[model samples]
Target: MYLVKIIKLALVSGAIFIGVHAFAQDDNNKAVVMGNFQLDGQYYLEDSAISAVVPEETMALSGFGNILYRKGKFTAGMRFETYLPAPVGYPAGASWSGTGIGYRFAQYSDDLFDITVGNFYEQFGNGMIMRTWEDRGLGVDYMLDGVRLKVRPSDWSEITAIYGKQRFNFDNGTQFVSDDLGQGIVRGINADFDLNSLLDSIVALPGQLSIGGSFVSKFQNNNSARYDFPENVGAGSARLKYNIGGFQFSGEYTWIGENPSAQNAQIVNIPDSLDPSVGLWATGKGVNLNGTYSTRGFGVSITASSLSNMAFQSQREAGAFDSWINYLPPTSVLQTYLLSQLYPYATQPNGEVAYRGDLFYNFKRNTTLGGRYGMKLELSYTQVNSPNIAELNDLGTSRNGAKIDLFDPGDEIYFSDFNAKLTKKFSKKFKGILFYQNIVYNNDVILGAYDYDNVPTKGTVYSDLFVFEGNVKINKKNNIRFEAQALFTNQHLQDWVAGLVEYTVSPHWFFTVIDQWNYGNGDGDDFHFPSVSWGYIKNSSRISVTYGRQRAGVFCVGGICRVVPASNGLSISITSSF
Candidate 1:
């Protein structure tokens, strides 16, 4: 049955692409078709040691395909997706089952104007005010389903406008509905100017400079029973970028009108009379700044941001990454190693101040301290904290209402990390890397834990991690890589050690073996997580398989995160583009 469904989807998608050729009106402007496909399936098994839960169906699968057509200045595309009760850790579940068209769009573009109707993704200046995008790996697809228009007045200036509804979910009800996307309608407009280009046309200018501004608003019906909800909410942002030689600086400030919703709601002490006048209502604001300088083999960068009640969403009641109208940019490094990802950070939108800094230097080759093949060193530090806010004292129970200062960094630290990496090529065929990291994680805030009395149940956890990795080219056709990692901590799950070995055969196949050991648990109990995987790649297509015991942890991509449950499963993945 699964195989039949897969083949059926492929055929349907192919037919859709092939049928587009009939729309080619001119022989000289024939249509060009392109697309890509991916499938991930997993079979679950019961594992008592790790408390792995087996799905009722024992297996799950999800897949998607996008087909695009282009001819002259006209373009169109459609994406079909299916989730057969997605895997255990996937964001989709029974609610997203079955198959249907997830996205479809038609666009026309020329030198001065561009327009798109149906579904599209867009962003405005650092995405502080508006951003519609997708990260399939994270199951985050917030494409707007409506109309978008772009007008370029000149080479140095442009304006954009959009009216749409953010895609929320694929509800395969009796009618197979995917539209009427969210509870609210979103509308936005933006204008951008290139100062350097505009001035250079009249007179020469140094370096480059650009400025942009955006305004986004959402409207929803006021049908609340108890609280007097605001029917319309608006947000705006201004941003600028300047570059001179090896130095660059960029910044943005965003502000939003009162928007009371579940994600950022706070209780207020009001009259006992059942009146709809008082409820969770508050405005929001955000600020982001960055500066960088680089020259030769050295580079340095610093970034800082502050957010207060910035959980902007279309649906007032939506939660957990749903109906988001804006995104808080990430400020931390992306960790790829298995254990390093166990404690990944997720951006806090409620109220926080974050900072990140990076320094990189490359040592010259064939010098006294540079060695034979040169060396590269990278250092990074990131920290996040609660915003400095004055209390309103309206809650009575405690000071709940907040008066935030966007520039002040608070005393309560949420998370901090310092990491360094040194890489070198000792020989023509060998390369090695040494990495170290120290993290201070506030579990009470980041991981979230509270007792029945609303008291904190977890404290801060400090950990030190070390990793060493090496790659060796055995010959022109064979290569080997290995990694050894260790983590020491006194809190949470205690200490861990892990190792990985991978072998690659030229052009086609690869195999991997990995294991993580919880050898220093505070309870004196030991556990082992082992996994094996293999893959084959050819051209643009690849297939991989794995059988493994996965530890429960947060999986993150660019600071956005989702919980992945513990599991023992056999998984298969296939991807191809054409």
Candidate 2:
């Protein structure tokens, strides 16, 4: 392993040299330099009560930095990453060891065309058919390494072409392996047009119109000996957008060829054994539609979407978040409150029908409903249901694994949420917010056995959550804030209460203390989770340190998620940009 690390570092150094030497060849133009830095370190502490464990290493560090240089239309950059034996909760199978250059890229651009070589991120049409991005918070990075070209001949039309391989892991070697599945080749093209811009002289239009389409295909050599899996899978998508004055509408639909992988593979249960293999591949498709209306003091939007057998991966064997060729847009309202998010929703890519709607309003300044600073309020509702499934055989052993329309709402409900928030300013120096929510969730369909148990829980969890928060301005450079929140429930983790308080001193320092207590659990003993943090900020840099117990749960963004383990530790984070 040590030898491998040395080789990777040497190769990375050579690449950097080559890139710099090439840039130096352009002596006429002055180069602009830029850089960024971030670091995070964790010291583990044991708390058996929360199932938190301390590994033998006792400590871990994970950090990265980026350096770049630009001269005219040409530019190049490299990102350095290090992980001294990644922390306990880091994504499994990620090789965050031995200092190495994880990402390096070079690009050149002009008014008509742009070209990039090495590693890059790309997305098409709301990311329904293809997307390659990174979310460090979730430990998800799906960058593609190869070549990309974009062309815009006129103001109304644009085209993009890319040929690359999905990055499975971090290494500068002949071979790479992902925790879920190895490497796979990907090729795609996308085109878009501004219909209004193209037809301005022919006809007058009141609103803008745009259209786009993308086709992406991936190839992975078949590794299974008994089954002839699909070596090449293709997905296509089309989208339309229109905005007229204060009203707007947009929609996207995706079609995926028959491709099955470990994540969404169809499995059947029988009287003799649990069948892990039945259907070799699944026919997949999905759709999303949304509309919004906005005026001076009010706004409203509604969205409906569905995904069925749409787990398209570069490799049929990839599981979890590895090698995802596309992303299913998040269908639920993202809850930001600490307690409100304790039971956040996770997207079901295999088969689900979901809908969400939101409304926001602000009262006039002098009206009774407005108070001193015009009052603001918002309302949101979201619901999701399982996709209608029909068994191919005349038996009840299948796991409801059948092709169905993305718009077909199944009979079984999976989850539902209704929430509202109201904000008001009692005085020039004081402000407050009140929130309420009701959520109904099916554990068996969503979280299964939440406590890491094998036996599934067969019941619905109904919870009503509430929160009251306020902020006070003491003076020019001092302020205070506090929060009180609770969730009333009779199922799953049962009932819980949480409180928080914070103080800030101008543009420099802040401190916070918070506690979440589970007063009602299956076990009689009440568990209280407490944590403290202090932060310092200056210009584009900031630093914070926290010590506390973290609950085990699944965290997600953009429909991708990872399981986080319970942990009690002292953690520090520092960030800066230049």
Candidate 3:
């Protein structure tokens, strides 16, 4: 393992030195130097409600930037990151406060092939089963640290392969378990090909056809343990797409191996008896399965995915960073408004099955009703279930005489929503949209599960929201947009009303103000949350400042979620490019 690390370092260092020295001598290299940087600094005003995490009236600064040089077939780049006084809400005991070259890599590409060393991002198909990427705002990044290759032998097909270890943050450190082993390794291969091209030479077929497949495997060394654990884990997926005239269809399916992590485990209900096999046995309450199955598409998708005792991660020993091996499909509808997201569904890492469908069409551009008005609609539904479990009991006067009990499996955890919207253009500068949304959410199953303090009670929340939005043109250099919404609901909180106004000055500046008020609460205490923000954009640089009172809620992307605390203060953000 040490030798492999040495070799990798030597290769990257040599490549960087050679690439830079060679490019310096080429007069017509045509290489362009470019990249961007961003800095975020915040000063918190004293607020007792939000001061538990950070001191009152304190300030913190954190920033990151990158530099890249691209010439004809070669490219090299590096990124620098710093956290002088790491911002609030960072993970407890996190020590990522320093300035260093966090990411460095070099790449070479041409008509036939492309290669990269040090760091890169890749995805297989829809990334339902395998994806390695980054989302900065969410603090999620899992870039591979090694070598990647891409090949194109023909015009109709391409292939890619990669081998590496996942990066956590700024440094490379080993995870120390009770029985220390070596680092883990991951490798994957994928290919995309056009079926029409192949059939054009062999047979006659109409329309366009495309298909792709990918396979990924991870290796981990296991030490002595009472239970059996597989050293090698593998997953694969396949996809197909067909388009002919006005009709189009696409589908994907993925299968994963049994790789249990922290997310999937069985819960034990212990009694007064000291016997190891006695007491009530309970399966983990959340999503738990044997392996994993996922199928999704644009036309119609019916997915029955079960994750038995499977906690997919790139490094079995590393902390949660860029280590997820499988993507957890979301089983709840995503709400767009700040108030509507009060009880958001966090993905159950243990198990779930979901089905979704979407349809869209356009009317003629010049008819009495269809000419100026464009009609659009959307509908989505999801369902969730718990894992199956078997109970065991053995503590008694006769040790050999033991009893086993199995509990009945639960029903689908949740179900929701149908939404629709219509838009019309009064003229080029004036446009309006009428929107309606209906959602039936199961609060007891999702939120109750997270906030265990509350007892589990079954109830459905139904909401009807009507919104009218439009944009107006004052002149070629100025425009303004307005929105007004009313929500009617009987469960949870009372009915609410909201509004927003935005003004933009062409070429560089814009400002927006929004407010939401719970007007029909029976308790007579109506809460109000409001904010105003201004942004300046030029080329690849942007700056934004916002001051407001924010309500707390769960923020999520994909299936990952984080709870954002309520804050009342001013925030500033700056981004620039060279």
- lDDT by residue (82-149, candidate 3, tens digit) is 66554554433224456677677999999898999987788888765567776655555667778999
lDDT of 1: 0.81
Candidate 2 lDDT, 198-222, residue by residue in tens: 9989997789999999999988766
Q: Considering only N, C-alpha and C atoms within 3 Å, which residue pairs clash in candidate 3?
A: 142-322, 287-350, 287-351, 288-350, 289-307, 289-308, 289-309, 290-308, 314-323, 367-371
Error of 1 at 513 (Å): 0.7
Give the runs in model 2 whose Cα sits over 4 Å from its true position. Answer: 1-29, 171-182, 267-276, 394-401, 452-458, 522-526
Count of residue pairs whose backbone atoms collide, per candidate: 0, 0, 10
Q: Each model's RMSD to truth, in Å?
A: 6.8, 5.8, 7.3
Q: Rank the candidates by lDDT, best first.
A: 1, 2, 3
What's the lDDT for candidate 2? 0.80
Instruction: Write down the TM-score for model 3.
Output: 0.77
lDDT of every model, 2 decimals: 0.81, 0.80, 0.62
Model 1 CA lDDT for position 22: 60
- What is the model-wide C-alpha lDDT for candidate 3? 0.62
Superposition TM-score, candidate 1 onto the true structure: 0.90
